[model samples]
Target: MAESKPSAPRFAYKGSRLKPLRAFCQVARLGSVSRAAEALYLSQPAVTLQLQALERELGVRLFERSGRRLAPTREGQLLYDMARPLVEGLDGLATNFREQVRGLDAGELNVAAGSSTILYLLPGIVEAFRERHPDVRLTLHNVTGAGGLDLLRSDAVDLAVGSMLDVPADLGYTPVYRFEPMLITPPDHPLAQKRELELADLSPYGLILPPKRLTTYRLVDLVFQQNRVPYTVALEVGGWEVIKQYVAMGLGISIVTAICLTDADRQRLAARSLARWFPPRSYGVVMRKGKFLSAQARAFVELIQPERSAPRDAYASGPSER
Candidate 1:
């Protein structure tokens, strides 16, 4: 009989492929090889090679180029969904395991929040956390709504603190603060002098609003549409501070969360409560469903919501207790 050819290995060791899997997941999360490379602290060529190796090993193209962005293909999405949790668990295992043993003495905590939350809400909480656990490394990622959710989904952030008008099915939000909506105008603006303000009163003056993609803009649009009030947008700005600056310069009035209206802002602009026209915005902590919290993250959450940090059994007894 002719000599039989040796068969190729049917499976490779899982340990050997972990590096490529991590590279693939990072690329998927960041949507670009270069960005992923920067995030992973690796060379772009190295990341590219790892991605190619992963694709070859799996016999599939994981990502597709879409308008200057690398979007995950269906197979890529599936692989990411399956591989992310495993990768995160393995990567975090050492730190979390040590934290569980050492009782929160050392660990890393990553949090995501928008400008408003970081500026108005987090100073005291961050101070308290630093005082309590100075050894723990804490990083605050300044991200907007969609970006915050993206970080939460990719396990980049332990939790996010922000306002959510709509909550996703796979996330849990715990409200920690509530702030009213306010309409702000320059001191000499016509609306500022009105004795009784109405939604229609805003129609004559131009408005400075955040980007249309933001929840604040959508809420403003919905409220105006519902009330049959017409408004004009003079400019679409990004940050509350920038919007305030424009408003103070007589460019346009703006609707802002009361959290952002400090005493300094009150001196330059006139702020009137719009509680009757708009709902109070709730700022909260958001986390992915079933995500395991590290000791350090749990401690921070407790500091943010001390009243809810009661004994576990107290919460387990009934919905009322919870």
Candidate 2:
């Protein structure tokens, strides 16, 4: 009888093995199997199976279930620390390699920003980018300031463009545009007639401000508090456009960044420059420290700030305050 052929190993090495590793890293980062599934665009059972397969292959319990959350074990943390960068590198390899060869002819770029930044800041930059690289896919994530930072930290976005009064330690911000604060009032309001205004001048009017959770509202509150002026919030709303509309309707005046002001707004409402009272706000590109920017993302950043591309330094050197 002929010798029996040796059977193949039960878990042979294949490109598909990377799937479980990717799923594991996502679950480790997000701390939830469902979230990892959503992020990976897989079913919950599929992700669960991948985790189980990974655990079996490694012969270790990677995570312990704590109610609805999955907490990584020591081995899991060790694997994650080793696997995350590898996974990120592998996942980005194609894009990076293409960018290296084609030099921005094609690739995908994801950017995140708050509503105001998307509405007021990115139109011209995006138009120029799209015209320049029509083949490259562009996705804009409309997120809040905190959400944008989260996306940046997780490498979900190539970069973020928005205002930042306080940047975190691990992020870099380069100011690309500056806009002064402006006080907006109905055409017939009392403060509209004043040639010059002060913080005390805004105290009595009912302020139609964005919710206190927003940076703009916080800045306004801080400025007033510093100046020892009392202000009233008649309504807490979202969006600069809505506040502008309400101000035009004589609901209450608002303090808003001048970036949103347009000729139509000038016609409908009285506007006063608040540069003397409040410092000019800067809108800029925010990125994670040490992130490797693909050519497509670099090209977009250059479009926004022609003076510079993504910095090569480990982190931004000094305070980003303007």
Candidate 3:
């Protein structure tokens, strides 16, 4: 046989490609080789070599020096966005796999919800979840819609349970429950006495509403504006309880979702369907687009939507908003 060139070293291409990609992601995230090295528990030279090898393999200049710090180039940023999640997933693979195998025996689940959802909608589901998975540390974060989305995006909460009128491109919203819009006032208020109400009937009264930024406020405003019925907001408040209290005290009449209408609330306030004008609001799970649900999170979600039947509190109010 002709003289054969010495085969390349056996170990040259044997190692996993994940090492360099992991190093690249760390350096991109920290913006400094030394910091990335410390985070990865590797030497600075090793990190530098990894980055160099990654750039050489991809044939791209991954970073450019910005003063004393490193910043990713356009291609670098694109790569970073794609690689970051993968690296994180792989890094947590061991723990996630163990949790998957162990089921809900031991794990933690963090959920975000608005006040109304937490107080009314989640009570039964939460109780059931606790009963089933007591050992699986469960925490429900009380946050508004925007705050909940922020928590979900940052991985601070595994999922969010709330209403979303507008879903973002990078997130997923699956609405599993619906609640009618209701016009609420003190039982003896003029509007409450009418057998049948019209949208124009609400025009003369000042409304108690959440801030103009909230969905409820915007929806109410849109309906009145569309029908050319002029209305005023007497107070811009935050929570459903506070709004209901203000309305019951005759501060102003308000429009609310049935989700907050309980038996106790009905005795204090008269609630009539405003569903004729505004659409029913849908509430359910909100999660990051590509998030990985652990065993604990999956179990909690199952409780929210059981296969046998809806939870006791799924429909918070009775047949009528009366």
Candidate 2 per-residue C-alpha lDDT over 1-322 given as tens digits, one digit per residue, 9 for 90 to 100: 9999976435433436789999999998888999999999999999988888787778899998878788899999999999989899999989868757685877788999888777766777888899899988999999986888999999999999888988899999988766767789998898988766678988888999888788888988888888888999999999889988999999999988777776667678888877777788877889999998888898888887522322222121211111
Angstrom error of the Cα, residue 183, model 3: value is 0.7
Per model, state how many residue pairs clash. 0, 0, 0
Reference-based lDDT, residue 280, model 2: 80
- In model 1, pairs of residues that clash are none
Off by over 4 Å in 3: 1-96, 306-322
What is the C-alpha local distance difference test score of each model? 0.81, 0.81, 0.82
User: Which regions of candidate 2 fall more than 4 Å away from where they truly are?
Assistant: 1-99, 306-322
- Candidate 1 yields a Cα-based lDDT of 0.81
The better candidate by TM-score, 2 or 3, is: 3
C-alpha TM-scores of all predictions: 0.65, 0.66, 0.69
Query: For model 3, what is the alpha-carbon lDDT of residue 78?
Result: 98
What is the TM-score (0 to 1) of candidate 1? 0.65
Q: Residue-wise lDDT of candidate 3 within 1-322, one digit each (tens)?
A: 8999965433222265788889889889889999999999999999888887777667799999999899999999999999989999999999978869686887788999887778877878888888888888888999986888899989999999888888999999887776778889999999999988999988899999988777888888889999999998889999889999999898999998877776777578988887788888887788999888988888887776523223243324321111
Tell me how far the alpha carbon of residue 216 in candidate 1 is from the true structure, in angstroms, after superposition.
0.5
Superior candidate under TM-score, 1 versus 2: 2
